[model samples]
Target: MPTISGAGFVVTTLNKILAIAGVAIVLGGVALGFRSVSAGGTVCGSAFQPAAGITPMSCDNALNGAGTLVTIVISAGVLCLIAAAAVKVVRDKVNA
Candidate 1:
């Protein structure tokens, strides 16, 4: 049985954390894109002539909501990346 050293274990754990953060960022991007497209396709206006990609009822609300969601998601993604990097630094210092 090969026993992992302290530095090796710490590095492996850090890599896993970074990988999870990467996945979160990718998923967040995909969600943002999907919501934007879905919101654009919805109707938000009343009897007035809808603009391009605007619907009658759901356009404004959906777009606004999606925008908010995108903001939150992007912020979370950034935080995740920062957290991953910070954790890696912490792990390295502790292992060193």
Candidate 2:
């Protein structure tokens, strides 16, 4: 059986951990988006409703900001997953 050096093992573990965290973050972001839409709809009425002074300014801002935040969080999670994958490829090549 081949043995990995301590540092290599640590790096591999960290990469796996990062991948797990990325997945968790992505799921959390998705949940947040769903919750925001449901809660926002309940509070602000249907989005299909006319926008002429029907929805409060605060509700509009909150909904918009929530969307932006979800985008940012999901993007970050994707980046993390990509980074972990890249690292694994590089590590494999180096060990090969």
Query: On a 0 to 100 scale, what is the lDDT of residue 68 in model 2?
Result: 78
Per-residue lDDT over 26-77 for candidate 2, one digit per residue giving the tens place of the 0 to 100 score = 9878876765333345454332332344446647765676777788888989
Best by TM-score: 2
* Global local distance difference test of model 2: 0.73
lDDT of each: 0.63, 0.73
Model 1 agreement with the true structure over 1-96: per-residue lDDT tens digits: 856788778777877787687678867665664543344545442222234655436566655666566667777777777777877787669667
After TM-score superposition, what is the CA distance of residue 25 in candidate 1 from its true location, in Å? 4.0
